[model samples]
Target: MNRILLQLAGLFSALSLSAFGGGKVVLPSMHQAAVGEYHWMTSQQFVDLFSISMAAPGPSMMVVTLVGLKACMPYGTVAAILGALVATFAMFVPSSVLVYFAGNWWDHWKESPWRHAVMDAIMPISTGLILAATWIISKTSIHTVPTAILGVIALLLMLFTKINPVLMMAAAGAISWVFLS
Candidate 1:
């Protein structure tokens, strides 16, 4: 239990620091660590957790807490709670501190040409990371033909339409419940 808790702390802390744009940017790495390296959960379980975290009101990075809970579940309830707390703290604190300091520095350099150049470079990098995360999640979630179709439709809607995403998500859920269930 101690070993697992420490591992969770280390993993989340590292991931939090590297989360350039947001939690979504580190999804691929999180998936790899939790599903591939640690075997804390299956790929499907990671995807399910990701969906839950996204649907929840708080930060999407709450997936780290879920992962820690799942990882420590075999130990017992107390351990699970501890794991969740440790992971959440480790995941949020360090990056938050960095952001605080970096934000101040960024403001200080508001008119610097290098700041603008760096921001421009980050845009493409962040986009690439987000695309990789999307690909990884889609690969795990879209196994069946109907699911694939639904995903494509959702993508198109997101790209081209002004429809509310929550509505689209609810509609997709209903469609899946009716047709795919």
Candidate 2:
């Protein structure tokens, strides 16, 4: 038990340091580690937890708390929580220091061709990850043509309508419980 916890802690810690361009950018790696490598949760579970975390307060990184809780019990939660904190600190501290001291340099670099080239290199990687996460969610949530249609319609409606996302999700849940179940 302790060994697995320690391993998970180390894995998450390393992942934290590797995360770039905020949480979404490194999400695919995190998903791979947690869902594929660790078998801590299913892809659907990750999607559900992500939704729940987003709907709640605080940073979207709260998904780490959910993952930690799911991975073990109190100890797992502690380790995961600490892992998240360490990850955030590891990323933030350097950034904060850089911004504090080298703010103008960073701003100047933004206009450099190298900055554009770096953005170009990273854009596809980030997009691919986001697409993979979407595919994983779709695989679980849209098992049938009707459900797929529902999802598409829900997506379009959210994009076009003023309806609250929380309300839409609730409605979808009710409909699923009624027809799909």
Candidate 3:
């Protein structure tokens, strides 16, 4: 139990620090660590947790709590809760501190030409990271034909239409419940 908590702390702290743009940017790494390296859960379980976290009100990074919970479930409920707390704290605190300091520094450099150049350079990297995350999630989630079609439709709607995403999600859920189930 202690070992699992330690691993959760280590993994989330590292991932939190490396999350460049946001939690989504580190989804691939998180998936790799939780599903591939640690054997905490399967890829499907990770995807399910991701979906749950995204659907929740807070930050999408809350998936770390689910990861930790699943990882320590074999130990007991108390252990699982502890794991969730540990992972969530580790995932938020270090990066938050870094962001606090960096934000201060960024504001201090507001007038610098180098700041603009840095921002420009970061744009592509952030976009690529987000794309990679999207690709990873798509690969894991879009296994069946119905899922594929739904994904494409959702992508098109998101890209080209002004439809509210919550409505889309609700529609998709209804469609899946009616047709896929």
Candidate 4:
């Protein structure tokens, strides 16, 4: 139990801190921790949980909390929540403090060549991580030809159509149950 809690906390903390844009950006890290590193969940399970988390009303950050709960119950949930909070704080506080003190200078530095170079360096790494995550999730999720077709259709729908994802997920799930199963 303690091990589970610690792992949950550590995983959440790592993703939370590493995330540059927001919770969506951390999905790869969360996937890695849960599916790849710890083997706490299968890739399909992780994808399903991600779907459920997105379908829920609150922020995507809640996905970590849900994953923790699924991993080890109440204690793991607490640790996950705390880990996210701590990790967010660790990233936020320093920037906030720096901004508070260096307001104009911070803005100026943001436009500097060095900053641009840093961003260029970071982009590829982030893209690679997201790609790896996509690969992993796809390998785990596309077990059958029908499922693969569903995934492709879902991707196309998400990319080209204006349909809500929750509805698509429901439709896909229903189709899977009725036809694939």
Clashes of each: 0, 0, 0, 0
- Which pairs of residues collide in candidate 1? none
lDDT of 1 by residue, 1-181 (tens): 8999889999999998988878889889989999999899999999999887877778777999899999999999998999999989999999999978888788768878898798898889889999999999998999999999999999899999998776787889899999988
Angstrom error of the Cα, residue 69, model 1: value is: 1.0
Superposition error at 102 for model 2 (Å):
6.4
Task: For candidate 2, report its TM-score.
Answer: 0.70
> Among all windows of ten consecutive residues in candidate 3, which has the lowest summed lDDT?
52-61
Best-matching candidate per lDDT: 1
lDDT of 4 by residue, 1-181 (tens): 6676667656665565576545566677777777778787777788877767777777655666567656764445566566545444543455456547888677778778998888888788778766776786677678888888998999999999999888898898899899976
lDDT of 2: 0.69
User: What are the per-residue Cα lDDT tens digits for candidate 3 across 1-181?
Assistant: 8888899899899988887677788888889998899899999899989888877778767998999999999999998999999999999999989978889788768889998798798778889999998998888899999999999999999999999776787789899999988
Whole-structure CA lDDT of model 3? 0.88
Candidate closer to the true structure by lDDT (higher is better), 3 or 4: 3
Error of 3 at 118 (Å): 1.7
| Candidate 1 TM-score over all chains jointly | 0.93
Candidate number that wins on lDDT, 2 or 4: 4
